[model samples]
Target: MASPALALIVGTLFAQTARAATAWRFEPPSTSPTEQSGNYTGFSNDTINDTEVVEGKVFNRFVQIWLENTDFDDARTTPAWENLTSRGLLLSAFHGVTHPSEPNYLASIGGDFWGLQDDDYYHIPENISTVVDLLEDAGVSWATYQENMPTDHFYGSSYTSHNYLNASAEDYTFYVRKHNPLGVYDSVSQNKARQGRIRNFNDFANDIVNGSLSQWMFITPNMVNDAHDTTTDFAAAFIEYWLFPLLEDERFNDDGTIIVLSFDENETWDVQNHIYTLVLGNGLPEDLVGTTDDTFYTHFSLLSTVQANWGLKNLGRNDVNTTMSNVFDFVARETGFENTNVPEDARPLLNISGFAGPLNSESYIPFYAPDDLTAIGAGGQGVFVSDSLDTSVTYGSLGESTNLTSIDSQSPWIVVEDKSEAKVAVFAKEGNGAAPVTTNMLAAVSAAVIIAAAVYL
Candidate 1:
């Protein structure tokens, strides 16, 4: 038996301990902050110089709008997309890195998907640098504006769900964590200051009005607006409603600014993983409007183009080979389009055949086969194999042989396999967990725990 005061103090301390444990449980594991040398972290200590010029012009601002899931044909049918094409340069041969979606988003920023086959919460090692490192190194300010985000740096899934069939008439959670790549990486998530820079759309609007926009801006719309669940027409309408006005705004129309609009991946993976991509803004030459540039480009091109513009170092990934220099003349002049070819040894590994099941099927998991297992066959059922270099290989259930050596070439490949099952699981799990707490919140709770323990003693 204990005194009433002692019992009360112990109970309170136990409650505090439970709460602190809960907070720590939900919080992502933190890594040591990348060493900072000067104003930037994760870069060399040498003083950065930004003297490099692109196409005899230096762009001070780069803005990108990332849409979701709409194929090129469907996107082209949308009036809003047509309007943009009429005003900018459309890339006819642009393709996403792979399917279904998360890898493409990761590839766009990190330059390599790292064989990430699903959208599970991934805390990339801090040592794995991103475009943020390059931008920060060159003294360029950058931010990601996510529409419908619950908080400034909220790293959860869709806030809520509405019937996609009634998307136009109903309200739903637009902010999706998978679509916002920066939040997933430990390099940004573990850094309070860097995480703070990822603000909601309201902040983006305010920044625009206040003329306080960053040099680099990445914008992702809500599910409904970005066509993740809705039709392409719906997404186009949303873009028309929101983005058209910005084109007219002087802030985005300055000669030093460039705006890129693209999709994360296509609707179906059975066909080529081609997506519509366009470049517009004051930086585009007047003569190039309403024209289609057929340069072969991938998400890597976007990263490389930015690096070229800022004279930044590469992350030594796919960005080194697949840069879209010809698409952006500035990059082409500095580093010839053909000169940035991907090394034969550096191509991503391909997982040929195993199991192709529903995204929610128990068999589905985020598995990346070893790089050496380029052609594998097991389970003795539906066996499909193909790569970027060999486009004529037969696909479907195997009948006679799994021998693909005749069509397999040494050229760099982009394998578009069935990842929709994993994607479905990833999207369904969004916003399913507790919100993560900040460092200050953790520290305060820790101090409270210490005090409570002292009082109990």
Candidate 2:
């Protein structure tokens, strides 16, 4: 018979091979970092001066177009912004400005981006509460699961306190070295305030499965499994295998849970600029499946939607009126609205960059990174990106298809179209690296480019 140790090794290898074979076709490049890029990695500031990859043709043609425009400079110029009315889901290009990760997270839920300068753990501020408070006021149940929070304190934050319950918490602890083998000291010290709310990430699934959590639920992946990358392939795999299924459970029917997967912010420079948000949930249209939303949306818009849906009080300057408006329409009709505000012309916002045909395999870009940016009640502002052609598009308006034209270096302008409501901002690209050279003036070019592109578009 084969040796026991050898058998175990062979089995492990086979499992790894099988897992790799079946994993999602999309994988970060081999250059992915080991430490948590947290939110900023894989970002490139270069825009496509000319067609790097031609559009159309091949196995993953759309993927090709995405890759060709994949760079920091390209911006969220060509994403498909779907507005999910009663008909289908509308995805907007979710983008946040700034370098660190925490502030963007605050933007997504609380608005105003909270000015959280660092990702270091700190007690919640007294002046600033979260959208969780708003949800609670609106009678919406929500939960946040931090992986590894121990059972004795389901709301624990320390690595030792967390218990990975199959469904819920149980009174379990281990003793070693004369200390609670799982140290509860750190969490006890750090979470001096509002310690009741935090819980093990596992609890999120349990709450959803057991029907204990309210309609609104928030999940925070552990520092590692959240694609922060302590372990390679862990975050992406967890999302694909574990989290997606939990969100799809039938418990949410009368009022479906709108599941949003986003990054807190970019940490590394490479992947930060093109961070992505994946929205999956009930009442989403099937025809709009697998589409991208290219509208410029910051975290405040996300908070605003949650506020509107739950009837919660606004938290910051960003969420008040400037936030995106179409997110609530799926349940709007059901909430007894006579005529919903959802727009009719539904399709992806089109970008005419590199209109050349037939994309080659070399320049393919996959969406990565998810960050938060707040814009709600206070002195909050949301940044918009677009060219001259898009300025005429309405702000905060959803379910409309937009068309863009070629960007000549001489007239490079980006328009901000808010289809969810009514706002059109016209701005231009700044600086030139390797370029078709849209504008002649080298200094202060971004401002000049917008003026020119607006005039022509």
Candidate 3:
């Protein structure tokens, strides 16, 4: 062997070379040449110009951590979660879109589930543009960090086996493709450049140390750590151990960084489909820490919040109407163009039956009906009406003098009985008809118009 001094020098030189090679630095792409050449070839130029004109909360980075299968009550009791809540903004009324986990994950990044209800290995078509497309168009970098994934861009139901139980028991590879929503989309999977961004969690540390972190980063823990195959305490411990350090790191905390920690869905379907959602980072105001925001939000709201901060266009889905306004103060004025308040009837009720796949069939048929509209008590004529903007009308059998609360509206209504059946209608203020047939019909018509506006506006 060579002398100790010589060996030490060689080792130091190798490490410096490695660091130099892997150092992550971001340089904004040069669009001046295209502009100078008089080649306004793509929509990016127009998007940049339009978005810059609007004043909004501009964030340097956004990081999201998605946990799995934990109820809001159970998750809040954990010390780790409680600690995070004390340091961040807690969303009390945040909810998930649906059950069985897959659709919620898809909705987080893709705006819509595309009618996905099961956890099968799905290949979404290329025509469907995800939030990744939006990020790229806005000149922002994005990536997905999944724990225990076999390698970068790994695409499969599970890393090793199709069966989750077998994979968890045999190899301890709990990385499931259902949790990796971006990997399933053809827009990302088919494109080599985008697929390369789906990296294992090990790369997260390397990127951080090398200063290569992207503008938008999505993180998914393994099944065991995320509480899917384990308990809430276990997931809590995992988060505290892994995330607390990053929160303290200057690389992630500097320059308006926002971190969102949320669960994919609730454990039980009987209660309101609320899940734990926490927003904490250096970007938030010091006074706002530990504040509770009781905003009616969903996964679509999270997507919209990011778009609002980055000045990106809506994906023309639920995100267009479901923007979260209460979290960021500047958001309300910036996103005035969007219909931030989603009507109570417009929201999809968590349908557990939606997860019921055919016994023998390989694929699941998407169920369109909302499960929250079950008949209750001795039924009469019941109509579920939208409180804000009179957009939706759902006619059903109502019980005797039942009080139904609108999800979006603070207005209260009491059911009254008519001769044939209890015709459910909006509660009149001073002097209004008991049940206005023409108004109810108009409400249905307005729903169609609002839906059209949501799609194209």
Candidate 4:
């Protein structure tokens, strides 16, 4: 007979192999840090919730629900927003990075908007990295949920009146790609598997039911529902239609989940750019319930907090800018990362628009190769340098050579139509006059991510 110790080890390995062979639609990467260091000399992998759950410092699941341009005062006085105050920690000083919408969404994930000051079309070069690159490298599961998104990885500028749920008004535009951040990146769009992961609410429902909810989730409601085309009360009605029941759903908000209810930016830009943000879910410490967190936070904090919680790398952009990249206090405290308290008077005037970056036609400056390799991120990890990065080039040379007029926003990310010879294709199409993108979206497929790590101490 086999020795008891050997049998035990065999049994554990067998169980892991079985779960990988079955039970999961996605497999984590072999580079998963959780499966490396913590996979050994410790208890079972802390990812008991789902294959995607990597066990962040303070929470296992993070769900960010982004509404649109309602100011702090406007949203706070609304019924749902008022009632929610007593349930979660309210962030009083969270502000948007810039005006309009797309860039703010881009800033949240990519760290910097790459000088994009307008809501117009843009596709950051594939060479530029984003949080998704870091999350996958570390073996974390992530996805976005766009309400009324016609199909997975739909590249349209906006999908109209496809309300299968019959939840929103008939005439409202259902989904807009501008509000969908990851889709804007060539890094994500060009990768077929990554494109399939940009899913609709139907997939969101299925993931919840299957208990395969991604550890990181971004949820964007329709234009009217997010308050972009409506009033504060209009958005409150959406909260009732959408968020209320989610609060009580275990699949959506288990004890380890934190759901962030925040706006992309404020409506009244002149008044200091503060937006109402609420941190809800069982993850909130009981003692801190109904409290107000005054720590200075911006959309970049979205990237930093996730990085800190998971011990992941940064994009080497604004994520290292300590001024704008303060991790959420709860996450910072738990992860041993410090956060700054920006005084109201000291806050950057975020409302003023135009000439903020290279995309600001009047202030156009070519992309600079950000000096990020040595810079430490909020997680205490160095910036993520792309494997495909041009090693031969120096920042000085590239900065001097770059031309704003010659750059194409969608050139590399979007495969040209008849110009297919100019670009490769999985499928090519455009939406809402969005710089040409994919008409042939990738179909949802299973993927595996298994890292070879010290399985036993």
Q: Which stretches in model 3 have alpha-carbon errors above 4 Å?
A: 1-56, 160-170, 322-330, 333-348, 351-457
Model 1 pairs in collision: 55-330, 157-431, 359-421
lDDT digits (tens) for residues 1-457 of candidate 4: 9999999999999986774453111111112211222111122211223464577789888899999988899889867678878888998888888887888899888877755666765555666678889989889988887866766776666656633334342544657888998888778876886886787666665566567778888999777667776566767766765677777888778899888999988877676778899999888778778899888899999889988988998877888888888988888888899787678788888776654243443333333445656888888888787776653332333322222233322222222233445333322223324342322221111111000000100
- Residue 304 miss distance in model 3 (angstroms): 0.8
Q: List the residue pairs that clash in candidate 3.
A: 380-398
- lDDT of candidate 1? 0.56
Please estimate how well model 2 matches the true structure, expressed as its whole-model Cα lDDT.
0.35
Model 2 poorest 10 in a row by lDDT = 58-67
lDDT of each: 0.56, 0.35, 0.58, 0.68
Task: List where candidate 4 sits over 4 angstroms from the true fold.
Answer: 1-52, 162-172, 356-358, 391-457
For 1-457, candidate 1 gives per-residue lDDT tens digits of 9999999999999986774453111110111111121111122212212233233224677888998886789888677667768988887767787776877888788766755556645445454467887677667788887766756666555565443334354554556688988976657866786877777665655566556677788888776667775566667666666667677777655787788899988876766677898888887767777898766677887776776666665554556643332225544564433334433243332221123211111222111211222221111111121121122211121112211123221001111112454221111111233223222222222243223212211
| Model 2 RMSD vs true structure | 20.7
Candidates sorted by lDDT, best first: 4, 3, 1, 2
lDDT of 2 at 302: 60
Off by over 4 Å in 2: 1-92, 151-196, 230-233, 252-255, 267-272, 321-457
What tens-digit string does per-residue lDDT give for candidate 2 at 81-170? Answer: 222222223344444544455434444544443223433332222223455556444444443434434432332222332223211444
Give lDDT: candidate 4, residue 339.
80
- Give the number of the best model, judged by TM-score: 4
TM-score of each: 0.62, 0.45, 0.62, 0.75
